[model samples]
Target: MYKHLLVAVDGSHTSENALDHAIGLAQGENAELTLVNVANPTEYMALAPEFLQHESYEAAALSEGNSVLDEAMKKALASLPAEKVHRHLLVANKGVKEMAQLLVDYADEQKTDIIILGTHGRSGLMHLLMGSFAETVMRETNLPLLIIRSDGEA
Candidate 1:
């Protein structure tokens, strides 16, 4: 019985599945849905200075983030009315862990009843290297979380 649901999307297939699930839950419960996309500042900061300047990198990241949010909004609107869906783009200047915290903080600000997100399901070396925002969020937040694996593994 969620009143406000927050779904994090990154234009990936996994996130798309999560969005679909969130939409279904929202429709069934007559709840409001919010779609969030986080832009990691570390990505831009990692780029070589000669290859790309910081200002340009930030601009590109923001643009891509907006595009992801727009695409997610279109898919969400197919299942729910525009009035029932909200969109948010968060800039995570610190890092992945901070990104997870930002999501939690945003959920608090929005008074979201539940958070829905998809896991890429990376394991072993890849998992170790890439880390997981979903895992971090789960560990840090007290709010209810629904995690959907990309390949239906969970």
Candidate 2:
């Protein structure tokens, strides 16, 4: 029933699984597929203080985001036609919004019927500290979500 589907890819194996699922769903419904990646320069800078150079960090983040989107587009192309699949790379605004919010907002902006994402499956203290992007997206959006866990749990 979905006419358009949005899948978030972070170049992880879990996201690969989610992309596979999205491809199947898109094929079954004859829907358009949009693959999105959000790059946060602040994150890379914070994690690697030695980088120190703002330009390098921003370049790295954007490069990584494009790489992720390109890889996902290649994979999706193998299953879906080039015309049916699209890609978007978003740069996160530091301190302005969380990644989950960015994903949700993008999905809405694209008018996607459903959102598909993979969960890292962190739990307990780790879950509390890292938080769950899938959970946050679900809470932030009113659209339908298909969350695939790292261990094949849905």
Candidate 3:
């Protein structure tokens, strides 16, 4: 049984599905839920022009991350008490570490019993080009992972 569950959300449909699944699992086990949204400033900086300031890009990323966490928290509050749910907004440097690594590190820090995430199920060229965060997390972390595929089901 999972005592502490961590669900990562990015405001995508797949992530919503994953949150639903996490909610069900947490409710069944009476587990504490932590909703995590990670903002990588380097991602925006990579696409930014030379004149763009790093601080401005990081601020925008942080704002977006907070919005994503707020939306996810609303859904969580519907099923769990506000006190039972915790929210974290993480800012990671993409140049130093990937999102999967950051998620894993946070899970370790929180002592999470399980990790839940959604996968878009991209394969072939698309998979290669975009990379799979879920796959990377599963490979890197030793904890149990429940991955919900994007198939219009929760």
Best by TM-score: 1
* Alpha-carbon shift of residue 28 in model 3 (angstroms): 0.9
Off by more than 4 A, model 3: 46-55, 95-97, 152-154
For this target, which candidate reaches the highest lDDT against the unseen true structure?
A: 1
lDDT of each: 0.89, 0.88, 0.88
Residue pairs with backbone overlap in model 3: none
Per-residue lDDT of 41-146 in model 2, one digit per residue for the tens? 8767666566554467778888889989989998899989889999998888563248889989999999999999998888899988867878888889999999
**TM per model?**
0.90, 0.90, 0.89
**Model 1 clash pairs?**
none
lDDT of 3 by residue, 1-154 (tens): 7899999998888999999999999899999999998887776766647656445888877888999999999889999988889999888876323788989999999999999998899899998887888999998899999999998553
Ranking by lDDT: 1, 3, 2
- Of 1 and 3, which scores higher on TM-score? 1
Candidate 1, number of clashes: 0
lDDT at 104, model 2: 91
